[model samples]
Target: MDPAIASKVLPQGLRNRLSASVRLAPDPRVHYPGSDFPAALADAHILISGWGCPALTGDVLAHAPGLRAVMHAAGSVKSLVGEAVWRRGITVSSAADANAAPVVSHTLALITLAVRRTLSMAAGYREGWPAFEARSGADGRTVGIVGASRIGRRVITGLAKADAGYRLLVSDPCLADEDARLLGAERVELADLCRHSDVVSIHAPLLHETSGLFDAALLSLIPDGGALVNTARGPIVDTAALTAECASGRLEAYLDVTDPEPLPADHALLNLPNVLVTPHIAGAQGDEVTRLGRYAVEEVERWVAGRPLLGEVTRQALPRLA
Candidate 1:
């Protein structure tokens, strides 16, 4: 597990629930050297994994005869669970919906801040006293959402609660016009969304077709001074292009993720006036881990009761994920 997550999150109740579910092994660090992990695999029936669970590979599987399922308590199981697990018929479920909450909350906050120029004003206020100016608010602000994924839909729902007059535009080939309407947004092409909206948020999965979707040409379409918020995988947007655009000081960005994440200690993005970068923490945190733990426990209960999994990942959707 990511040391940062294991240390801060993962409370006692959740740990106890997992322990009661299986013949849980001693905590890895206390029982075995990191290099000697696979030796204990034979005893693991279900791997309840989180941010830093060791990769489940064919070699690891060779030792675990009883392994049947992998319940991940977070989003994007791609990094830890691999093709071998799928080939071996191991059922998997991820708490992606639970994790989507924070990202949507973060995006919604950025949406309102961007429209009000909150960051810029905060900077000015801190650097030197500046005259107050009446400016436009979120009322009637146009927000363009790039994908209709879970996070995107959540953002739309949150936006509906605001008193600001708001109009939403969305683009996602997989989504139908009726679906977009139901989500309270108008469906439009990606280019049109970028060209017209005052704020744009990206929530697409990082797949072959979506990798670098926001290349130079498409990025250039965003109106100047418009805010671009990305909480998705960094590779979904062109890093070089984004860096250049942000460096120009003409566009504003609120990024929770970046390609080559945890940018070098002295990376220029850290100093940029228009860029707000956070170490990929848009997902669940604090008490949120409990939400995922409960999700996993519920799935386990369903499985034991001979019921279908509530969050099963299908083979058909595998290729569409990051």
Candidate 2:
């Protein structure tokens, strides 16, 4: 945790809850620091992590001989740990499940708006409301999910239960056909998913192979007026290609993350009414952050009691995780 968000992430109430199980760290700045970090590693057994915690390198680990585990209070521990942490055999866990709920809710909302042609319709409001033929509805629309990760599966489950009767297609190199069927989606190749889907929602993790996956060719396969929803990672989608499609008004996008994130002030995506680019606010925020804090606190309780960790993340699984 960064010193600035330490108090907020572990507020007084949550701090009290954690303190009941284990002694509280008197000063977060000791371990939560940047380039010129000075960690209080001596005598510490478990490290609670959050955003801005520097990577646990070998030199940093040398000081923490007793450190045994890391309970991350936020989503994605990809950048938080290194070979040093794993080499030490320290158990790791993430509060990503807590964060997923909000992202799922937001992705579903974007899908709803996308299927209804919200962006294009809103932009053309001055002319008049859409006529019967021009109006779109969620029912019978096809939504392709890019990866069957936790968030993607949850999104598919939500869609399956929705009254919209959405036809779901999933594309994940790691997913099996039977599992896709069980998740209430048809397994398809990425190209086929893009070609047939009315809305292509991205949930893939950023990997060397997946970077720029939704390039010009794949994006062009999406039917005209289709929408693209990405709340996963910024680099997964080709921002420039997406901008071209949206600018041509042949596609619409609901992007919560973008490559070269926080694009320049004059980025064309920002000016296009058909594209909605938000500042990575899809995850837990404001009051919702308490859930993540509470989730981490509960994980600490589990570890202290020798119970199974519900959010445990393993070194072997890191390559596949978001």
Candidate 3:
């Protein structure tokens, strides 16, 4: 973690609790691998990691003979944890569960706006007020979830609890028909979900198999005037195909992530009236960061008490997880 983040996450009070429970590094901010980093790891039993923490490799682990565990204060340990850490039998935990809450909430809010055609309406305001018949209702609107991930599951739960009576459809390889029913959703193939959904929200991980998953053909399956919402990794959707869809005014989108993130200045998607392209702001940020900090602190507490980690990450499960 960066030094500034270390201070915010482990303010004086939490730092004291950590110190009382176990030995801590004199400085908790080890963001990079360097000579000083190895010396700092000497005699350390655990590492408190965060967003900027460097990858743990063989050379780095050689210096920390006593390290047994790592508690990360951020989501996605894919970049933070390497083969060396797992080979050493070191326990690892992530604060992804804490991070999922804000993403789900933000995504749901976007869905609400999308279902009502807020962007298209606002874009055409200068022309004239939309006729009553042109306005859409949220009631009985079909929403499709592309992945049954942590965030996806929470979004399904949110849809179930909403007063709008949304019809939920989910497409995930691992989700069974019974499981979808339990979540108040219908298990459908991706193409079927796209064909039926009024709003489609993506919550899948970025993997070799998932890259460009929403290409021209799949994206074309969406009904006219439908909206697409993406809070997941950018490459999962075809950037060029999406631009063409929104360019023709056939579909609307609320994209929090982009294939070429921070798309070029003249990118078509940036200027589209019906598309809401935001920098990735759906996850924890500002005040919400405290939740990740609190979760990491509790994980550390649990570890000290010899309890199973709440956010445990095993090497075998990494490929299937976000």
Candidate 4:
């Protein structure tokens, strides 16, 4: 319920629809005063949440006697949703699919640029025309995707349509062989994908098991001059190891997220010629936020009409999602 999200991101029509069907609390901050919230929640049948919405705790649930569903207008419900909501049988829907487009599009663009060594080429162009060689082309290059998450699948779809003759490799324990084949990618182990790929893009989630999944050893496995793209969480890859690899000019990275995000201005990563860092802007920018708001509104309408939501989150998926 951040003010910026409510006032800027959501469309007026969607906001009007939500206001009509749900009793929206006016506070834009994450948490509300106990007195203000308890009274408002008592008759609340559905909660529409967005960035900065308060965590739905057991104590909070105790106040909402009639709450049946929650519609989230953003990606990743892990931060706001807790066990209490699930335990109370409160259904939930997220606009993650709508938000995935920006990340997937960003990844595809990075893959194309990295394969062509665009960053280096651009730097050379700026430093006055210099003799250059077409060292690497996208033709016959291998693109390894770390996970077949929503964003990863979309990236594959775009890659499939590109003129670049790139062989696709995928690594995800949960991804079945049939699913990989359907995406036109060959299934492989994480290390094997890193070893064989000309460009490796990570789209995995940040969970206990996935934290620092790409450490020194895994990073070292990337063939020299190969590019690594991480549109996923920063903690998934060891920040220090990535900086070291890129600093040595043995690897190139297009990182949109990083551990301890917003790395200091003086961080070595900023100085590395082979590294391109973005401030976690890969997902849901510009008018894309309207997509998320519209999705949440539609989900709310579905719940009211007794239809199942298209973006329903299962209790079982929470463990792998966070």
Candidate 5:
């Protein structure tokens, strides 16, 4: 883990628990992209990794001859793992599951607001209170989920159990009809999902095929006054097309991630009242970060006890992950 966030991620109390199970390195400091990094890994049997850790390239791995596993205290090992780690046959795990609860909760909150026309209605407040006929709620509204990825699945589950009586529709080529039905959703094609949904939430991975999926033509299919939510990657939605829709007040966008991400200071989307662009904070942050450290530490204990790891990642599954 990076020293900068070590206190929050692995505080003294957790460190004491960790110390009881594994031998603390002689130098209990941290480094990566530093002269002392290689020396730190010299006699390691297991590596506890997190954000800011260097990719385990072959050269870096050479320093840890006996390293058997890596427990990452963060989401997505895609950027941290490489061909070298897999070739060495080392076990790898991520704290993505632990990080997912917050994103799922945030996304669900966004969906609740979107279905209620919260942003548009709030924008209308300056002119005068919205008419009783113009107001709406989540009850009986159809919500489209773009991909049934890990976080997406949880969002669907949340919607399914809502008393608001949401009609759930999911879009993912990998989905089976039975799977959708079991999740209390109907599986549909992407265009069909866009055409009929009152709100479309993106959960798909950003792949070559998914890039710009909600292009001008498809975005135009969303009913006038509908909303679009992207808690996934930014490139999956066409920024220019989305901006035009929101600017016209014909649609609302709740975006947690954006294409240029952080967007330019003067981007039209930022100035739109009905469109929201958050700083990718739907995931864990603040005190919630402690969950990731706890998850990673638990995985370490499981591996040491010869128990099956709960969050293992394999080379074959990296492409499908966020």
Candidate 6:
């Protein structure tokens, strides 16, 4: 893991516990495969990896003969894990569940604003106050969820319990009818969801099949003046298509992640009044960083106690996970 994060996440007390229990590395430091990392991995038994850590390739694993478990203090392990780690039977865990809470809350807040046409209304304020007919209500509005991911399911539950009484529609190949009903959502095809929804919130992970899932055609199906909220990975929605939609004032979008992140400073999406492009801030940060630490600590304690890991990740499950 990056030494900077390791120090803060595993404070002295937790570090002492970890050190006392296992043959932890003398220095809880080792990042990518470069520099002094090979020497650090020479005798390490368990690896605590985090963001910016390079992939654990076969060559890298060769340096750590005793490494058996990996605890990731970050969200996705896609960039860190590879075939080599799995072949070695190395157990993996991630703090993605811990990170989902903030993203769900941010998405829900955006949904509330979307239902009320907040952005468009605010944009139009400079011209004049919105007419009574132009204003929209949150109550009974249809909200479309692109995937039944961990965050998506939570958003569904939150929306279901809200006073707004939103009609939730979800689109995911893996989501069954019973599960959708139980989540208080109606399972629908992507096109139908877009066509009827007043606001569409994307929660799908970025997979080969899901890449460019919301293309020009699908985005066009959304009702005029409808809002699109995506806290999910970018590239799932075509940036050009979205730019054109918002530019025309036909749609509004709240984007925390963009295809080409930090979007080429002068991108038109940045100037659009109805489009909001944030710097991928829907996940844990600031005070919320402690949640990740606590979750990782609990996971480590469970692993030490021979209990099942709450944040465990497996080779078979990685493809479908975010």
Model 5, span 62-103: residue lDDT tens: 988998899999898888999999999999999999999999
lDDT of 3 by residue, 125-237 (tens): 88998899999989989999999999999999998999687999999999999999999899999999999999999999999999999998999999999999999999999
**How far off is model 1, as Cα RMSD?**
2.5
Clashing pairs in 2: none
Better of 5 and 6 by lDDT: 5
Better of 1 and 3 by TM-score: 3
Taking the tens digit of each residue's C-alpha lDDT, what string does model 1 give over 60-103?
88988888888777788888777888889988888787677878
Candidate 6, 101-152: lDDT as tens digits? 9999999999999999898899889999788999889878999999999999
Using all chains and alpha carbons, the TM-scores for the candidates as numbered come to 0.91, 0.96, 0.96, 0.92, 0.96, 0.96
- RMSDs, each prediction? 2.5, 1.5, 1.5, 2.4, 1.4, 1.5
Q: How far off is residue 294 in model 6, in Å?
A: 2.0
lDDT of each: 0.79, 0.90, 0.90, 0.85, 0.91, 0.88
TM-score for candidate 1 = 0.91
lDDT of 3 at 81: 82
Name the weakest run of 10 consecutive residues (lDDT summed) in model 2.
29-38
Clashing pairs in 4: none
Q: Highest lDDT, which number?
A: 5
Candidate 5's displacement at residue 208, Å, is 2.6
| Count: clashes, candidate 2 | 0
Error of 6 at 307 (Å): 1.2
Tens digit of per-residue lDDT, candidate 4, span 58-93:
887888989999899898999878889988999999
**For model 2, how does the per-residue alpha-carbon lDDT over 145-219 read when each residue is reduced to its tens digit?**
999999999999999988687999999998999999999999999999999999999999999999998999999
Cα deviation at 254, candidate 6, in Å, is 0.3
